[model samples]
Target: MHAITIPEPGGPEALVWAEVPDPVLAEGEVLVEVAASAVNRADLLQRQGYYDPPRGASPYPGLECSGRIAALGPGVAGWSVGDEVCALLSGGGYAEKVAVPAGQLLPLPEGVDAVTAAGLPEVACTVWSNVFMIAHLRPGDTLLVHGGASGIGTMAIQLAKAAGARVAVTAGSAEKLERCRELGADILINYHEQDFVQELRRATDGAGADVILDIIGAKYLDRNVKALAVNGRLAIIGLQGGIKGELNLNALLSKRGAVTATSLRARPEAEKASIVAAVREHVWPLVAAGRVRPVVDRTVPMRDAAEAHRAMEAGGHVGKILLVP
Candidate 1:
């Protein structure tokens, strides 16, 4: 099998596609013949030597993929060889074939193709688990998502809207915000010029957002707390803006706000299975109903994953950038 490997982490140029040994399936895992994979910020961090794959995970950078099942490992059931599936992976999506835990697999949605489905798993599970399951965003609630034009942000906008929540997004430009608006975003703040905290508060008549899906971590922590409505929930999923910041406990206390931070890659397999199951039950039907869909910026060949990484770093894409194998 051929896969993207990093001989030495540096930049996008570090992603090297070369022949590698095929992955041997572990118990409760399956072999997936890769069709497509998606670029993510984590992939960029991995390529730059800032993030390493979890212990025992694949060395490759990709975290999600869509492919057909080639074979299953012991203890795996309810799926078969030749099944068309998209899966959440700990690593190794940027490859010809990958070994995936059966519990992380999701059947392709009714109207989505293999390439497009490649972008769904990570964003779907990330948003659903944080916004719905943990934060308990309800109908009439408002969700403010940073990096609104991103894969996770785009998915968060749609899912929040589908659940009858008002969606607000912070993007770098008007065009990207327009794209987010088309996806049901109600309040748009151009972070380059506007203050999201003030804008969000104004949009909600000073009530602020009921939930915030934050990707910019510490750089936005103070404002994220300020942007919250009473009892609001802030789910932090990325640290693109650096890792440490002082939190205003008094401000958080005044609002009775709660904060949670999580990463899917290092979670236990059983926890991932639970999230996948919840997504299949709650989100798959939304796709089938045409109420939710993937937002892909473009597709690049698997060998040219470096190009995809460049696009993500450029921060101009409106959604997921895919890599076809």
Candidate 2:
């Protein structure tokens, strides 16, 4: 087997595709022959030595992939060898083959092919867990998403709108904002030129956002609190803006707001299974009905993962980038 390995964390150049030993299947796990995997911001961080894969996880950098089952491990049932599936992985999606927990596997949504399905798992689970499950965003509420052109941002916009919420997004460029609009975002703010807090308040008649999905963690924390409506929920899933920031407890108390931060890669298997189950039940239907779709910017060959990482860091893509093996 061959996988992307980082002998020394540095840059995109550090992602070296090389031969490695095949993964041994543990009980309740399955071996998947990777068709494709999606690049994520976390992958970049891992390459730079800022983020490490959880204990016992694959050293590779990918968190989601689409592939066919090659074999099933002990105690695995209901799924069979040769099943076409997409899975939420803890790590190792960059490889030609990966071992996945049975609970993390999902049947490819109807009408979606293997290559594109590679882009779905991480964004779907991240957005669904943060926006719908944790924040409990409901119909008629206004939800705001930062980095609106990103994989998670694009997914969040469509899912919130599909659930009957008014969706708002902050992107860095006009082109990205236009794409967000095409995905059902009701309000689009060019963060490079405008204040999202002001723009969102004006868009909602000064009512503010009922829920905010944020990736720019510490840098946006104070402003995010200011942008929230009373009793609002803010879910932080990434810390691209740095990890340390001060919180104004008085402001939060006055608004009765809540802030939560989580990482899908670090979650326990049972918790991930629960989230995956909910996504299959709730999100797959929307996808199958053509209400939501995977937004892929482009696909790069697996051997050129370094190029994919460069593209992500350039911040020019409007959606997910797939690495096909």
Candidate 3:
């Protein structure tokens, strides 16, 4: 199988396309002939030797893919050969063939193609787990999202709105903020010029946001706490800023706010399976009904993953970047 492998970690240029041993399916896994993969910020970190795949995971950069089942491992059921599916992979999505846990597989949402479906897993799981499962965003709650133009951001805005939450987002530019607004964001903040804490408070009439989804970790830590309403929940999913920062405990305590963090890639198979199931039951219906959709900014060939990484680094894309395999 042809794969994009980092022989030795360096930069996007380190992603070398070469023939490698085909992945073998394990118990409760399925062999997927990958149709497409999508780029995430974490892929860049993995390529640069910062993020290592968990034990027994594929040593490739991709975290999600859309493909067909070429074969199934022992105990697999409710699916068969040639089933069209998109799956959240531990890694190895950069390859033509990846062995994915059957439990993590989801049927391509109605009206979506393989390439577009490739962009679904990471964002879907990230938004569902963080916004719904962790923060418990309910109808009428005010939800704030950082990196509102990102793949996760777009998906989060849509999901939160569909669930009846009032969505607010922060991005770097007016164009990106407009895009978020189009996706149902009620309040938009240009982070480059506006203070998110102040804007969020003003947007909510000094009540602050009920739930805040953050990607810039250390840089936003203090202000995020200050921007929370009473009993608000802050879920940090990325550290685009520095990882270490001081937090004002007094602010959190005063607001009775809670802070939590997680990475989808680091979860156990069973945990991921549960999230997938929940997404299938709840989120998949929204996509099927066209109330939500994958936001793809561009599509690049699998061999041009280096270009995708470069594009993401340049920060010009408004949504997900797909890699056709």
lDDT of 3 by residue, 212-270 (tens): 99999999899989989999999999999989999888888999999999999999999
How big is the positional error of residue 39 in model 3, measured in Å on the Cα after superposition? 0.4
What would the C-alpha RMSD of candidate 1 be, to one decimal place? 0.7
What TM-score does structure 1 among the candidates reach? 0.99
* lDDT of each residue in 149-186, candidate 1, tens digit only: 99999999999999999999999989999999999999
Instruction: Provide the lDDT at 77 for model 1.
Output: 91
Full-model lDDT, candidate 3: 0.94
Q: Which parts of model 2 are misplaced by more than 4 Å?
A: none
Sorted by lDDT, highest first, which candidate order results?
2, 1, 3
Determine which window of 10 residues in candidate 1 has minimal summed lDDT: 307-316
Name the lDDT value of residue 203 in candidate 1.
Answer: 91
The parts of candidate 1 lying over 4 Å away from their true place are none
Give candidate 2's error at residue 208 in angstroms: 0.5
User: What are the models' TM-scores?
Assistant: 0.99, 0.99, 0.99
